[model samples]
Target chain A: MDAASAAIVAKPASVDGLLDLASRDMAGVDALIRDRMQSEVPVIPALAEHLIGGSAKRLRPLLTIAAARLAGAKDDACLRLAASVEFIHTATLLHDDVVDSSELRRGKVAAHLIWGAPASVLVGDFLFARSFELMVEAGSMQALEILARASRVIAEGEVMQLTRSHDLNLPQDLYLEIIGAKTAELFAAAAEAGAVSAGATPEQQKNLRRFGKNLGLAFQLVDDALDYSGEAGTLGKNAGDDFREGKATLPLLLAIARTGPSEKAFWDRAVARREQEEGDFEKARRLIAETGAETATLELAARYADDAKAALAAFSSSNSWRPAMEELADFAVQRKM
Target chain B: MDAASAAIVAKPASVDGLLDLASRDMAGVDALIRDRMQSEVPVIPALAEHLIGGSAKRLRPLLTIAAARLAGAKDDACLRLAASVEFIHTATLLHDDVVDSSELRRGKVAAHLIWGAPASVLVGDFLFARSFELMVEAGSMQALEILARASRVIAEGEVMQLTRSHDLNLPQDLYLEIIGAKTAELFAAAAEAGAVSAGATPEQQKNLRRFGKNLGLAFQLVDDALDYSGEAGTLGKNAGDDFREGKATLPLLLAIARTGPSEKAFWDRAVARREQEEGDFEKARRLIAETGAETATLELAARYADDAKAALAAFSSSNSWRPAMEELADFAVQRKM
Candidate 1:
């Protein structure tokens, strides 16, 4: 067995420990979220609740709470920042679903589908503004700056992906950059903001941010792999959605590279022109399995999970959050959904 | 003649003084907007420039600059705030165009029409985030708070209008509330943020906010009136847009009330059902003019303009910006477009 494989087997894959530890903090964040999402405009709250209430884990805000408590935060400032982080995440998801014409989110009908795209867009704006208001109340300009910059970077990443997602020739580094900006940047910011709110040392802030960034990469890589490996019932979102959308995720890209000349015509027809027939997704999945692309993708995810765990070296092992967060990193890669 | 009519005739309706007085400062604002709008992603800048570069008046940002200067601001902080105000306005316009499926904005094709709705939505998100980044750089939490609240209020107003705008029986008070939240709140926030940035006294801030609120009401009333009374060639946007969309603007509602039983069937078919034939817009305009609805709307706008001017009485008459701002109020009601 490879060192990476051995490490993956040795690590426990569970978020239950962190969830237990941060239960009170997460509840406070949840309360703040519900309170702030309300508006006199009936559609705003209805539409926001449709998506927000469906989220099971809310891992991004969990990162904030866990990072804050890990850094020995004593005040409730991190609670607001945590809620603000979730709001920012929710706002982006609303915009993203509209941009992608996504049909389902968090195992339910997407907000845009239920309320119409216009309402979804406007409600997203409302949540985004509400997030800044929460940040302002938190009274941490440093956290505000981090989240604001993350917001801009996320938008930029979305635009870049919009222009580049369909191109089969897109480089691996650029793809990493895209996901780094769109997904991992927010995770990094969320943890950093929490640390900043807690008045953590600069080194602690940087390390927590590093942990979040790597964990987010692992989470997204697993997400991409699960689009092929996961079943629709367990995945919340439909499996093969990326394939149907012709999104150039790493699993498909690696499969294409590994299959090489034999699949050239197939990829050109299926992906480049976005024409598909019955059983095409099945065939792609089969090809990916034959090429070991799914395994390769999971391996990459596990490496990132390992890096995420390593980032906790600065924190004392005596602290329970340290080991639980390492388990969270493993869970990010191992979870099926 | 009544005192109101005499006052209307006595006032000089021109923005030329304000434009000239703030030309140098506005130039700085213009430069800041241009520099900030640029992005590594090409489409963002391209789409942003489409709407922003076409705005000849930029009334909101102009209000911010005028308010700061009138409050005796000697620093460049107001310039960043002014630029931020414009970004907020521009972001809303981009999203608004998508929500309304608008074809034209600021005298050119709407950005969404050229780039597609997804691009427009994402780019608007970009600009909105960029607005906050600019606010953070300005280093005034008070200004940030004011703008953040304005943004949330604006989104709520839009959602309310989306649900209520098409109703033929929408009351005038409700209509005023809709427009006040949708339009006036930002104007009020812009001026107040400027005042706050300049370290103005609480009274100065309150008066400037009042000035902006009244000016915004005057501006919107004239706009609603112009839909029936102005020409497309002069208006930039097509004339009768409100009537075409069956929007229950003040003039339309007033005309509906004044014409009463005589024109009941025509309104029911044209506005209530939104089922119009070729000549419906022209006929609605004719009814509005014949009923003196357009004139009543303008009279109300003139009153608001007067209130806007009165709000500036606390500022010294010696400051050139004071008279310039008052002229801007007059011009809001007086302009043909």
Candidate 2:
């Protein structure tokens, strides 16, 4: 990490503030998640619980709760919307693991590996459908519209990534667009939907959505960087998984650009042909560090983090939720996981 | 086929009456489907069109339009809902083909085969989300609830079938439950939602739902029977697919029970172990035929068809749609496909 990034990290930025603030609402959301996921089909709940139970952060739903509370929510309808957001997130993760043939997720064996891809796929559908059911019960057409569009956009992003993410010459803007759609869009929708549930003004909804989008971008940028720099134990997924799969994530792409011709043969061998060998990941990581690619990625993430905090400036400083949310932006970039 | 079943088949029941009645509405539905299925992602539209363009009979949406018109709909809202129903059905077919790993759908190579399973799965999600967006456009939370619940039930049924469809000793009621959820719930919801769109009375909505449910049951029963007795060319799918997959559809189950000890070794090897030789499907077909299992299945289908027609008695005979829908019920069981 760069000196500035390292210094910020040394201070131990944390989501504890946001978590504490949203704890009670999140408890309700968790209960709703558990209650709705149950089915007489047995495997539906079993497979959903296998992944959802492993999820420690529940970050997206927390975003919903925090945004709602920040917008002065008076009722518990946001609780249902929060649970709906988590279901959408969980459904995407389930389908993503199946699509990627992923081995691990959230520090546990992937649900597809346990329940089989067919079950995982079907359960994902069930959760997606259930999310809509919850949204309907929440009785906000606006929130439902936001989430439905987000779900479609996320699927499009996944398809785009599947077909384009492996290209060596893929443009950086395209990659950003893919992540913005796939990852940041959900974050934006979660926050916006929560704000809508609380009857926030359009201006407030726009600002909260901006906050979430930037926060999500920062989160994904840091996650991509961590794939090259962090450990599997803390990451909850194998650190070198993206590298082994030859995914053209930001760090690797940046490193290839910075190193120029010096790493041409290495990139070709490791990424193009995917003829990876022992220590290849270590070599790639070393090159990323040596070329300052990891630092650059972290710097970009910090920029987004700053943008995320700035978006919350419209809220009153006296509201504790405001600072808690700003701290969440920093935590997005600073967390090792 | 039994004498009565053969006589019914000789009469050549057709969907032409319903097709003529809903021809204009169906054209609107077809156009809406084309418009909504398009995406900026190239492969999405291509893959969706590959399956959708090959669909000669858009039956579910037809039910929606027919039901709405029968219930005195004057607005075009039901057209959008009809398109939404088709999207839901197409999405399920895409996922179902992937889960079953079938090579044919609607007489064309399955979308998963052409675009790969990941694309198929994501596109299925895209269409599903798009279905909800369309429902939102239709401006009816009631319709959205019905479709959303139907979607969840369908996924649960898919998982249930994935886990239980292969059991040699599967019960008749359990088998009916699986198909009912997987295939018939959408039909019932489609009709009910259409009736809702027209502000139908509760009794009218109930009758339409019954019409749809019974018709869907007959359709699936005939489809199951066709897997054993019909020609692949006429069926638009491999005739022995269920047998090959060791799926205990009613025909195979009934044949196993009625054949008793005589075919014990055959069922044990062919179905229980899925150890089929070159002519095993042919042998299974002959056994199913000789034991009158196909006739019994068709007889049950006929009963459902009769019930479906009876449900429409509440509608005025002067209204052309009532007869068209009744004919549709017969078409469901009597069509070769």
Instruction: List the pairs of residues colliding in candidate 2.
Output: none
Candidate maximizing TM-score:
2
Residue pairs with backbone overlap in model 1: none
Q: What is the TM-score of chain B in candidate 1?
A: 0.97
Error of 2 at B284 (Å): 0.4
Candidate 2 lDDT, tens digit per residue, B22-128?
99999899999999999898989999999888655889999999999999999989999999999999999999999999988888888888899999999999999
Estimate TM-scores for all models. Answer: 0.97, 0.98
Output the TM-score of candidate 1: 0.97
Please identify model 2 stretches exceeding 4 Å from their true place: A1-10, B1-10
On residues A33-65, what C-alpha lDDT tens digit does candidate 2 reach at each position?
999999999998888888888556899999999
Deviation (Å) of A149 in candidate 1:
0.3
lDDT (Cα, tens digit) per residue for candidate 1, span B92-163: 989998998877777887888899999999999999999999999999999999999999999999899888
In model 1 chain A, which range of ten residues has the least summed lDDT? Answer: A3-12
